[model samples]
Target: MRNSIFLFVLSLISFGTFFQAQKIGDGETVDVNGLQVSLNITNKESVQVGGKPFDRYKVSASVKNSSDKSYTIRLTSYPQIVLDTGIVELDCVNATGAKLTSKKIQLKMKTQMINVSYSAYDKSGKSVSNVLPVIGSYYFDSGDIISDNAIFIVPSGEKPEVNVRALR
Candidate 1:
């Protein structure tokens, strides 16, 4: 009976911690596996995609890998919009250029390669080439802090706070 109760309590704690999310606002940092990541809303505007208008938010994500072992992180699954109505998951594009899905990154050991991944597109639904990184993966050596920006579109008039799931 005592062991069952202890196990139940332990499970409850683990479950809560697993689902816990951190609301990281502009310039706020979240640490995961000794990697420091900060996100900020750099700009916002209305953009045309597939002949429809959408509100797009340009977010800058910075990551510093300081751990001994490498880690892979997914930006599409981790980034979310916190609004008054509810939480909105950012739209993502698959590798084949399809919609409704997300992105992932790889952190290599030894060399400390931080695989930063994001999906970005321009007005014509093409990969952006201006100041933003395109829809692909990026790598950085270990112990190096790098800053990159991505464009995420959502409903109009909803200024959502950036929420990131710090997963291990």
Candidate 2:
């Protein structure tokens, strides 16, 4: 009887752990502390950033508040590109060709923020687009959803896996 009880408890613990650590697939939504996040590669193209042509990817990222509470968060981390060679991360430049400066969000009432890909410029205002926005923090209220796109430069013909921070 003692051995059976011990085995039962062990199995229960294992079962609970298995549920908590489920693997998330590409484009699947993941819940992090009551926030739901989804990231997927939408398209790919070849673009020139600094007189050199490069292959860039358009990634769509969205965040939704799954909780009833309002909270503020900071996006201090950016997504990574997981490749067979190594992991890669790129900076998100704004239209003015400057790096994004905001990383804080005040989500209220389950709100969300989405980042989309657009034309990125340099200091000279030249068209250097296809860069992903740096993941920063934001606030969310219950039921709020934000979606946006970002551009990331990677190798041609290589569909690299996007590694968003929430998946970790």
Candidate 3:
């Protein structure tokens, strides 16, 4: 067996039984010990800074304990977005951090990566009571599309008639 190191900053529960994953993405759901956890992304706003336009994104994370036993859960999001305006001081914050910024204006924020860690479960099946983290980033480049399977795209719109581009 190959042993691998995890990037988890903090995890208390092993959750071997419900170890679905360590990182999550937008609109993705994870189940742990009869608890349902989901993450989502939404467009917050658009603004112009220094004559440059910028966009803001908001990430909402939530956990629902569906079991009869009372438990606590915490969720955190690690945004892969990077701040790159070519300015040293302006590029200090990350894409995820800028989304949470109250100023509501971030420049050249581009989403590059996103990760979510959940409140681990112990052998005794206990959890921590903490609200899930609200993460945000700029750009909807689908920076967190982590699918191992193949992807197929089917475009559906105003289909052009066959004779439209035929013999003119």
Best by lDDT: 1
Model 3 Cα lDDT, one tens digit per residue, 65-155: 4546432122234534333421001111224223234311221223333344567667788985444544344331212221111111112
lDDT of 1 by residue, 1-168 (tens): 999999999999978864564555666777755667677778888766677666676666766777775443323442333222111122122111213312322222222223455568978889854453332322344677666556566555655455444434
Give the clashing residue pairs of candidate 3, or none.
80-113
What is every candidate's alpha-carbon RMSD to the true fold?
15.8, 17.3, 21.6
lDDT of 2 by residue, 1-168 (tens): 999999999999868754554233347877766767666768767766556555666666676768786655544445533222111112222212213322211222222345657787788989875745453444455787766666556444545444333321
Off by over 4 Å in 2: 1-26, 47-54, 72-138, 166-168
Query: Given candidate 2, what's the lDDT at residue 167?
Result: 23
lDDT (C-alpha, whole model) for all candidates = 0.51, 0.51, 0.33
Tell me how candidate 1 scores on lDDT: 0.51
TM-score of each: 0.42, 0.40, 0.28
Which candidate should be chosen as best, given TM-score against the real structure?
A: 1
TM-score of 1: 0.42
Better of 2 and 3 by lDDT: 2
| Full ranking by lDDT | 1, 2, 3
Candidate 2: global Cα-lDDT? 0.51
